[model samples]
Target chain A: MSEPTSQPATQLPSRDAANWAKPVDGLKVGAISPEATNLNVEGKQLSGPLAGFGQMWQKTYRIRLSGADVTPEQVIKLWKENFPQFWPKGNRFFGGVGIEPGQVAVLNLAGPGGLNAPGGGPLISTGIMVIYADDESFSFMTPQGHMFAGMITFSAERAAETTCAQVQALVRASDPIYEIGFRLGLLKEEDRFWKYTLTALADFFGVHGAEPDLKIVLVDPKVQWAQAKNVWHNSAVRTGLYTLAAPVRWIRRLAK
Target chain B: MAPVKLDITTRKINAKTSILDIRGEVTGSAESILMAAYAEATAAGAQAIILNFGGLEYMNSSGIGLLVTMLIRIQREKQRLLAFGLSDHYRQIFDLTQLDKAIGIHPTEAAALAAAG
Candidate 1:
């Protein structure tokens, strides 16, 4: 045992500041798997919910691990380590190692009904930046060309005896084309994707057959016509063009 | 440390402006309270709403999301949203999330009021 001293506690900086990512001019991707196409991510500015064209929506998906005797910290540690493993098949998340603040992760997402682009590339090639991360939660903000302009936070919390894992998204379609996609079944696909992800997460904790609860609110119903120009940054079209030009690039390389 | 639940009280500054004095943490749980305060401000016929965050102790990404949600509602109602008293930490958060571009941030209550007019 040590004697208590009379020294005052040293002032510490805000804890939240350490957890948040520093501001970046634009997202830059680091190392990613060769199989993952790094399109629509580099040099793209982040677009939050206010920078979108369609109606704003808030979606919450949660699953309870009733019998799993795990703390929120434990759950979050595993979730962050194996984030990509829990996603639905055909969607590749090229996040190196683990999630951390300011890290940019590339995503190759399957289209509705697992459809691929004409050249067999993913239907969408986009990415997200980890904006905040801590012991019990982490958040990802999308780039401008992604389907939705917003952030999604994944967290775990203890309620009574059980621990609940949650993914809450506040988003709006990034452009008119994406808005039309959301209206035409993309929203349902997104819903299914999160439900599947949560179910998989539950299963990992030995909670088999757990059905995730979902709640969606149309936060704003009016579309922002001013954001219609955002279609120029559409990732889908850009990714398709890049894929189609693959052979030409190979031919040019051979000539050189 | 135990979290402090957010408390909001609306003060009418003038016929066209109302100030919402918010205390404690602004997290996901503060949604209903924050929205209710905004409703009260709008009901009082306030054309501009100012958020006073002088007493804010903590906030998270979810809190920023809630602000975006509230901003949409305010825009739909054709009301201006201004804020004062954000700490340097939260001001950086607003800048990082690009929210500062949408919601006007002022250094003091008087400055916010002047902008509201």
Candidate 2:
């Protein structure tokens, strides 16, 4: 693996610097919709692939808008502006009007088969921080209690004649319980979720019947046993307990 | 601006250490090349791998994802990954993504080699 001593002398560009989010110790959710619950998101540190317990996986879902005469930038513009609208029926993403760097968005995700909590909230309440964003692509990093520990990038690219919208996630189950769920077919649910989003996106561009291409790769098969303790901060468990305690809070409010 | 395709060259600095000089932008397209370079370094029995990002012009979020993928591979092989020559902007990207916690970042190539030692 030896190479000659010739190295390029190119002056690097720094234009993308402003596109990245500045460092923050923890995430803080801004104003969100009343429909979204902001539990398990505030003051949480971001978790990356290294902080996960399960085997790491990289999945890419893409759909080509063949009939739509839109550029990559145009696709990204609509995708970022109306990000949550493209989600599958039950999931909800509550963020600001537009996606940008350093933005924090809360998510209310349905359990299998679109199950909701007794309090009419989605089963899992987690969030993501927008770590990077640009015209062509934007990426979100999961918070500590999210289902997965890692980053997901949504991008649009000019592929030959058509524009291809892609969602790529490099993630691992955040804790043991989630790891078990992933092993027991939650992975397929995740696949269906993103693929549905892509199909919706294509439909939004007037291109119907678009089939999404899926690719899954096992990046690392070893699970980090040290991260098993992450289950303590699992959002699903916390959300369930919070829902169960809702009546106590209502009683306290009545007393006050 | 025209996109600069990623170019990588690997060189063994010592019996246990190898360095990959990364040039141009790192995006989804750079995956195969980057992985091939890492494979070469590991095939040479390198216990520590150093990344020289002096010539790197741009890297997006997908590029950051690639580094995480590479980090997983390095950890599986029980090898150390160190980097230097990152611009201040790129350094901040590492910090924001929390990749600095996993990969050691040094001020210079000599510093990275010393850390590898």
Considering only N, C-alpha and C atoms within 3 Å, which residue pairs clash in candidate 1? Answer: none
Instruction: Looking at model 2 chain B, report the run of 10 residues with the lowest lDDT sum.
Output: B1-10
**What are the lDDT figures for the candidates, one per model?**
0.88, 0.90
lDDT of 2 by residue, A193-242 (tens): 99999999999999999899999999999899999999999999999998
Best by DockQ: 2
What is the C-alpha lDDT profile of model 1 across A1-256, one tens digit per residue? 1221121133235657788988889999999899898899999999988898999999999999989999999999999999999988788899888889999999999876667776678988999999998888899999999999999999999877789999999999999999998998889899999999999999999999989999999999989999999999999889888988989998999999
Cα lDDT tens digits for candidate 1, B12-81? 8878899898888887778889999999999999999999877777778888888998998899899999
Worst 10 residues of 2 chain A by lDDT: A2-11
List, in order, the clash count of every candidate structure. Answer: 0, 0
What TM-score would every model get versus the actual structure? 0.92, 0.94
- lDDT at A146 for candidate 1? 94
